[model samples]
Target: MRPMRLLGLKTFRHGVHPPESKDETSGLPIRQFPFAPLLIVPLVQHMGAPSIPVVEEGQEVQRGQRIARPDGFMSVSMHAPASGLVRRVALAPSISGRMVPAVYLEPFPGSTQEIEDGTPCPLEATPEEIIAAIQDAGVVGLGGAAFPTHVKLKIPEGKFVDTLIINGVECEPFLTTDHRVMLEESRDIFTGIRYLLKVTGAENVIIAVEANKADAAEHLRETFPSDLNGSVEVLQVKYPQGAEKMLFSALLGREVPSRGLPLDIHALCCNVATTAQVGQLLPRGRGIQERVITVTGPAVKRKGNYRIPIGTPLRFLLEHVGVADDVNRVFLGGPMMGAAAPSLEISITKGTSGVTAFTDTAAERTHSPVYPCIRCGYCVDACPIFLDPALLGKLAATEQFSTMTDEHHLMDCFECGSCSFVCPSHIPLVQRFRAAKAAVRKSKAGAA
Candidate 1:
């Protein structure tokens, strides 16, 4: 075997190495969380226009029944996770801290967890037909982006796609959803990839996984028959290696132009879990109702990977997982890019990949007094996209958001939090950039 070398690993430049913090749940098998009293399926789960509710309050719905329809091409439909009665259509708290229109369901007593909904499409379905099936199944990028899968897969006019990149690199700490999925649901993942290859007509497929999960890579290598024009590439365990641009560069050595997508480089990337869902759901003609998630952190009593139903409340998850009374913070994703949950009443949407709770001790922030930058270039050294975070943070502090974007290349930063991680002064650089970006967007919207 080749010697293990961190420097020899395939990775991009300038990223931080935070604590892995995954041992607690990495080895645990995925368990199914019991149904909550009520499910709150939100319309605004996807990135585009929210779905429109097709059912009325007090109406009955079956498992895999459509409750809402897409409002536009960019939007996606919504489905019921269980056979139940519609409790009401009302505004509910979302992780974004905003109230969104949602369909509430009171599941029928003794309803089995089986999904018996959807019409099967033939294996030889045409590309257009497959795209329709995907849209009908309500598939989205499950890697936390939640962009409509069909929108990303549909090759636009005058454009061509050559390669499909499947991301199995669950590099985020304390999250093992994708790792477990890659191991337990390997066949489904490949089935999804085959559909993806057919959808985009890509010449080849590449599945990128981190070195930490070499077993998953090896399993795929051994079990996956060699005719799919696909290969498993092991990436160096690095923070933000799962970022689309960084992973693209690390694997292909090609720089995606700033503000450009993978499709611009004749490559399209999809989360492995998302692809697996397409493969699993489309053939059965069923829609997505739940997904695998990691419910792990220091404060969680029963830490493990879970196949959780979509629309399960955060309170339900915390109560089911048995969080400590002294839990200081709960986040919706991983520590690096995940957002803090504002309320326990907020339901888990399709985009939610992990539910993490940190106790007071684990969630403590640096108490050292904030100091001015010492002209240290640590932030610069840690930035993967080569943006000067110190400069951008200063510009943001002064409310010069326009200057930060136009001259300093502020938007290029994917907010992977590397600069903040390495900053000796403990400056909240990522927070500032996010605020600056939001401000710029708001300003542009107001002008428009």
Candidate 2:
């Protein structure tokens, strides 16, 4: 046990400072969002193989009961979010605009919604057992990546992790779900940290937070347990600072090798919200059924943080939040990296952290004319990864997808949108890069 040290503000080179639009919901406490009559629980809410349905249509399930089982080690299980009868198990619209297999559940009106618990994993459980419990619990990176948490915790045969980093640096604007989770779920966070420490065998822990979340930092400092070798490090406010590579550079000054993982550098990073879920669920033998989300934007009349059930349809959520008549576009997650909803019928998944509704006026601001790149070097100056987006953009325009990856390191671009944000020419640099990368992947897969 050591005293939790509050480190001085630190940051990596080259990032943007988008307007911090978090004030609208940062102060709001998380409230339980009312369930929609029909919950569309997608089987592919996470990365990897979609969970296979274990309960069939017309079956009754209690809240927290396992509805789908993980297909394999790379996948995670799924649970019922409420006491309901399975209406159907068919293809449903997901946030990604894909029609994936899903369970359509209709909640019984006035039901107790009692949760069915499984075998709890105790603190003293072995690392092997803990990892199994986590996968069975269906925890994933709630910070938007939705990578299965159990898969991440399983260290490779030869690799060793000495440090565990809890990421609380929600640098994306208009998103305060992680901030609210930090303030309200401190106890669960610490408990999650313990589980992560055991799973990764990390002797030291660092909770990385941006200076913009001073209140969250202070709250965590006050509640930090005196038994763990961990500290809360406040970082300089910057866009994409929460990325795993950027966090490594800002805190440890270590650059993860290009295309390498955190474990390559003896470090493991987990989202604060994800960690809190691990702490909150494993001990209770519960699977993840819902998550905290920040629902806000200019077009929203009731902006706040909410504990929303998984599979809640976007249309229902927006209706509950009261959107403006002129609401023209709605996106899941933050503006910089979120995807626009192709249909409001798409259901929220584990990866969704924020819901932003923009009016026609707000959407029109981004419709500026696209001009040729002037080589003003603004994109290079703003790229956190130090790749030349201008060159990559040109290669993409010429359909030189292979050249873009081979010579310009186009694949290294995380599509943080900083290049597009700072580009004076208003070119869709990030969008172009995304398309180019997809082309490259398709080519490689076809050749294989």
Candidate 3:
């Protein structure tokens, strides 16, 4: 392990320190959320082709039954969150504000919610076999990326991974789902680590946690398996510390090349919650039906972490949790890096990590006046990727999308929001960069 720095904690170079705002719910334990009357299971939850529906309208599906099968290697299967009647298969609102194919289900009121078991993948299974089982289980990066976990485990030909970095750094403020997971599900995490080690062929592992979650770090350390070849490392508290690139850099003192992946540095980083789910589900022969979510904020009356079923409508969630009447805005994740919900009609998906609601009073406070860039270089200092957000913002204002990507390494930003958060001018640098990157992608696709 790399030598510790200031205060005996390892950390990356550039990042902001936003108000954590996690106290309201971080102490709370995870609770199973009541099933919604109508669950809208989006087939396109992960980052790939949408899954194809296997059941038609009016078909009865038991809890954990496969409702949709993966379209291709890039996609993942979907399961019923509860035993219910398939109301319809149609386009439904997703958190992205797009209407995608979804399976609407009316859960049976008094049916036993038993999960269907599939073939269990033992530790001795071949790497290829284990990866296939992961895909079958519909496991994805639970750290809000929603990228298929099975695909990530498949190291490209001719490349090798030496280290597996388990990310427990819940850097995004107000999201304690990971913290709770580490405290409550250490066994599943260790079991998952064994599978991950076999899949990646990593010689050793490192469970990275931030200073803020010392309790979780300690808990994992105490329960850590003696047979495993890794240890837990506490990192300095910093925004975006949970990012794969940042975590690897802090732990191994290695920098992933711009526009590159962890595998480029012979390392693999997986979210702690995602790892635990892999351990919890793979042995049970079950697919992902629900995930833990941190639901909290000023406008929420009963804020806490919830084991929420995938496809639970945001409207229903907020209603059940008791939101204030004057709640002005709600974000699917934390304030930093999370997108604002365009409509409450949009349902939760695999990537939904936290539901943060804000009151009108808080919204008004946050909607501060924007001013011209003062060239203070605060964004430059805050950006974790070492990009000049000041210049990027200037380019974005002039609609120079191509220039931004071609000349400034715009695609490497990852939309961490550190630049926007630290900008005294309130320039919305991250938002502009997101639009610029999208424009660049569209232009490239059109040219192709």
Candidate 4:
């Protein structure tokens, strides 16, 4: 209707502002990180079913080869990151610490960048073909979640998606990969949107960028020539604003039901980097080989955005990037909501957007020794989900899984880390609640 009267800067009600370490490379252009001698690709990069292994250890595979096939509708295929021989198809350490199945490839020295089977397709492909092409490309959400884009675009039978909300809000501190991609690959981002709109039958396409990245917003607004058939809206800068529900709330002023997705609210949000890759893959018919990752933290020597390959070992990435020799912790994503790695020896996955090397000092403020809650209600004020994280934290502390979900609405929590970040008593609210949720889910599964 009435152009919605420029909401100015829209955002959710609550969130905490952690240090925005994005300055190191916020303005830097996207550059290809040099191919490591060995690439460690994972089998379950997407959210659902894991891919089925197609290549065996020591299998001589060429560049653009299919290393694994989609396990089901929920899964996407895995491809060779480079022209190289498969070194091993075994369990490898992931950034999360646990061993996950991986395809190790030692790149052929001076491997050709040329694809062996690049059948260029015209952009005028039908919706079904475009969806199939996306699946063939093995593209997943490059923004942290790693959800299969093909699946996301598949609007359920009678359901209609009214808007395609492309996420350009790199709200996570220390991650500027999306910002650089927006500035550098605006064309690719648009290309991906054209196909996404066609496939999803979405009449509206809105690119959502945060107000903090004003330079990136200005660059895209200037470059896109709004004369094109799309909408770009700059959102209010807020922590967790990049999250699906928060961004949807900021743009549309709607809240996705607890434990529900944006699709439930007639919306679809895709990361700018993922869409850019969709642009690259829809035509070339290739799989995800590598992606942009922001490497930063107090311990790092050269902190900036890096275009790292899938399955690149964290140890190698950190060492190459020049982190301080003695590091206390390494986080796989941003300081908030990211999983801390047990060690730096884990391999990067499709969801690995930033490898944050937090030294003793950098990791200090975000956490503090837990103390008895004074019923301060600070967490209540800080929670974007409106759930009582303080109560959830209490339940988790006492191993009360049922109470956390049934009474406290633990599932509603996105684990945005705001509760943990804002707690004066230094409570690890998010981590404990996550464990409680997992236990409840397991118990429910057993009951079923």
Candidate 5:
């Protein structure tokens, strides 16, 4: 097949251009973070029912041992990140602002991080076997979504996938986990893609990297095996271009419906880090207990990607990295779409991609007053989904969220925060939309 390009630069419509604050750690190689004394592995780390605890409190467990069984098919299991004694099986604070069931493990001083249990599977396994191995490995979308990777490998009866798109577009500022992974784990990525191809029966795969990381793109293209049916596509740099929908547009010019998914267009997109993890774990029959994460921002003393255990607490991690005394805000993901960490007590989960702390000096510009919208169209121009955030913000202010969704395409907004970033008014448009969405979801749940 001939190489496909979306014309010059190749990008989707309407997005913000935040300063790429990645200079600090973009070039730094990944380093391993020492295990904290205790880990808090949340049962509901993925987007499914929380896992049911299989081990009782005070029970000793080995690193990578299964302590919680998946609740159902939609859920994924949880594993111990280190050899330790189960301190408790109780609620813990999550970045989601809710207390979720989590297993607290106090690591043994002499504990080795060696994973001792796994049934190695052959590469030529059947689709069912491959998917089962993936699920047993506990691999999820390491891109921050934390969706179980096994679920994506299963092809529905009628639906056929054509392309497995590996998203290497770390478009968010100050986050270079995917970029570093693409450079360091290219072989694993290819291995994982081949496995995905075998499972889904997809014709080919494409690794999409933004032009900002041209080196990674070049490296992947140069390193991609000649035998495999895959290629590397460099996309135009844009915020949220890393989003699955926007990525589809930039790479294949396919538009997923407002409420639809990439699967609707016969495409599967997984993060580069997630792909590497799958490639590394499935063959060994090992579970996901540790992952590489970017710890950066102005307030962080050591801003680099570190491979950390799944349940390491943010407080301990931040302290090790040496956060500034004046740090006022911390986010679990990227600033644009990441959830604000409610407290430092929250532990890192599968979904965590980065931990960004901002000092008062750095936060001054971001904490500006909420000025009223001046009828400027910057928000509309910046909206990638073409929704009127200005009007949505207005409707949200007056508690007219129902009408906003019914008529103004409120549900279509993915809360990329582009509108808010571009707005001169400093209106918290994204926050308003989030509140409105929460309210709508709550109302629907109540009605149901």
Candidate 6:
């Protein structure tokens, strides 16, 4: 392996490291998860405005056929996973606990794996054209955030993106989807970087990985430059190191101001999987009807990485993957910050990067009642973004939404769930902040 000509960038301050159950699935290669007979495609799968449904009930659609269209600037389109008959497009139960618009499809028996819809995306596509192609490809950040990649690629006026920071550091525990993608899909990653460089016009491209995944780092180190004009960089294996602001800081020595974006620092950060998907889909002009996900946990009997079609029912995934016996708790992503679904019956979305299941014994039961803060200041020390979660929780409890912003930097909280993780009182500190922030937004709109 060649030595890295590494330019170690400045990273952000304090963060914590919870137990990362990475070994359970990190070594496993990618495999296809058996398609669920029925799919529930969420309209708001990708970050941004909800996609407007175009397909109607009983319509026979081919694989890769567009079922939804971009409703706004920050949205991406949705596609049929397989050549299937559209059962219906109606309000369905989502992982978000509401009836969001979803497209229900019954997979056609023995549907051939075929879904290419447009001319090959040239590496030299113009900035506008590239963004359009990316949007057309249905590319969104696959790291659970699901932000539209086209929006990130399109730099606004007066904003020059000199650096394209690739997030290779999969900091979240039990989530090896990014790590496995880096290991197995090196070619796709390189191809993705080429497109990113061309679209963003970035002079420098950096792939930041943690020290733990030295193999992934080494693989990228050898393949990146050969793949494009940019470079790959290895950094300290730190939690939240993959966060845009933190990754920018770690690789570029710049800090994105609170409530600002990496764009503010003249940098554009993208998930490695997003780039890999871009490489795979853009040339074929295919929409993101499927994504790679890591399904592993103590509860799962057969744990490995699987390429699951978007909109497949989560229960089917669990059952097919040998979770038939265990799996009382299911996490959509990583355990540290991932959302817990009450049941596995909800359908997977574009953002479903990993499906983590825990057995009854493995699932930690927090029987202790929520107690008052002892002023231990543990959450204060653990916060990576440097917000006082204790105060925010208290204010939220008292319905002081206005004070949460006027005094505390409530909007700055990205709801990373760091504070909640370290809270000695078992308080749902992050949830309180989320509620408070939502309330503040509501109050502001009411005032207007």
Q: Rate the local accuracy (lDDT) of all candidates.
A: 0.88, 0.92, 0.92, 0.81, 0.88, 0.82
TM-score of each: 0.97, 0.98, 0.98, 0.95, 0.97, 0.94
* RMSD, every candidate, angstroms: 2.4, 2.7, 1.2, 2.3, 2.0, 3.2
lDDT for 233 (candidate 6): 70
- Leading candidate by lDDT: 2
Best by TM-score: 3
Clashing pairs in 3: none
Residue 165's lDDT within candidate 4 is 88
Candidate 5 residue lDDT tens string, 1-448: 1213455677788788999888788799999998898899888899877889999999999888888888777788788899999999999999898999999999899856678668876679998998888887777888888888888778788888898899999888889999889989999998888888888888989899898898899999989899998889888878988988888877777888878777888998988998898788877777889899999999999889999999999999999999888999999998888888999899999999999999988888777888878998999999988899998999999999789989998988888899988989899999999999999999999999
lDDT of 4 by residue, 11-48 (tens): 77878787787887787676677777788887878788
Which stretches of model 2 miss by more than 4 angstroms?
1-8
Question: How well does candidate 5 match the true structure in TM-score terms?
Answer: 0.97
Per-residue lDDT tens digits of candidate 3, residues 206-259?
A: 999999888999999999999899999999999999999888878898989988
Write the residue-wise lDDT of candidate 2 on 1-448 in tens digits: 1112235468888889999998889999999999899999999988999999999889999999999999999999999999999999999988777799999999888997888999999889999999999999999999998999999999989999998999999999999999999999999999999999999999999999989899999999999999999999888888999999899888887788877888998999999999999999999999999999999999999999999999999999999999999999999999999989999999989999999999999888489999999999999999998999888888889999878888888888888999999998999999999998888899999999
Return whichever of 1 and 2 wins on TM-score. 2
TM-score of candidate 4 to 2 decimals: 0.95
- Give per-residue CA lDDT, model 1, range 265-310, as digits (tens): 8888999999889878988889999999999899999999999888
Deviation from native of the Cα of residue 106 in model 2, angstroms = 0.4
Write the residue-wise lDDT of candidate 6 on 1-448 in tens digits: 1222234533457777778779878888899877688988889887678999889899998889888889888888888888888998888777778778899999887967677486767787777888888887788889888888898788888888898888888888888888889998888888888889888878888887877788998888776555355666766655777777777666666777877887888999889999899988887888887888988888888889899998888878887887746557888987876788866668888888888887777776445678898888888887777778887788889998878887888898887787888888899898888788878888789999
Task: Sort by TM-score, best first.
Answer: 3, 2, 1, 5, 4, 6
TM-score result, candidate 1: 0.97
Between candidates 4 and 5, name the one with more favorable TM-score: 5
The candidate 1 region of ten consecutive residues with least summed lDDT is 1-10
Task: Candidate 3: list runs displaced more than 4 Å.
Answer: 1-4
For candidate 4, what is the total of clashing residue pairs? 1
Model 3 quality (TM-score): 0.98
